[model samples]
Target: MFALYSGSLAEPGDPNPYAGGESLVLPKLWFAGYRRMLRVRIETGPAMQRYRAASRLN
Candidate 1:
């Protein structure tokens, strides 16, 4: 994730290492929310699958 975020995963000699950071810190804040959503999805995925299966049986 860090490599991808830092653009190290891109092809060599890429000009831009990072994007959307002219001066403000808005992108960091947005990334924080995105990480939180991924965490929640991972934590709740099994429970959600179970709920769907049970609902289908009703």
Candidate 2:
């Protein structure tokens, strides 16, 4: 039910397309490693969300 777009660029065809007139180019090999890092951060980020969700449970 959750739709998330992390690596989404301006152009669908190009994975690391230009952004704000600046060229965005990330090595394909590096992407695999980068993706894994981002995945871990995202999954662990829920804890930050939960703490903020409650303003001191009272």
Candidate 3:
């Protein structure tokens, strides 16, 4: 996972040099695959919950 930060200050006198001025460069295919993984997780979340509940009952 990657984190994006903007306008972040490191100290009272120090500030991020790239903050608000730079953008992250990532491959389009990588971003697309990440999004697909997220979609699968979201779609299966409810089913996983149901499976867990049934296992507890059994």
Best candidate, TM-score-wise?
A: 1
Model 3 ranges off by over 4 Å: 1-26, 47-58
The window of 10 residues in a row where model 2 has the poorest summed lDDT is 1-10
Can you list the residue pairs that collide in candidate 3? Answer: none
Instruction: Give the higher-TM-score candidate: 1 or 3.
Output: 1
- For 1-58, candidate 2 gives per-residue lDDT tens digits of 0112334212223453223433234444334444655666665687866776775774
lDDT of 3 by residue, 1-58 (tens): 2322221212223333444544544333334445555566766789888998999999
Segments of candidate 2 deviating more than 4 angstroms: 1-26, 46-58
Q: Per-residue lDDT of 1-58 in model 1, one digit per residue for the tens?
A: 5523544233333444334557345445445445555566766799888998999999
Instruction: Tell me which of candidates 1 and 2 scores higher on TM-score.
Output: 1
Query: For each candidate, what TM-score against the reference?
Result: 0.42, 0.34, 0.35
lDDT of 3: 0.47
Backbone clashes counted, model 1: 0
Candidate 1 minimal-lDDT segment of 10 residues = 8-17
Q: What is every candidate's alpha-carbon RMSD to the true fold?
A: 9.6, 10.9, 10.7
**Candidate 1 — which residues are off by over 4 angstroms?**
1-18, 47-58
Please provide the root mean square deviation of candidate 1 (C-alpha atoms, Å): 9.6
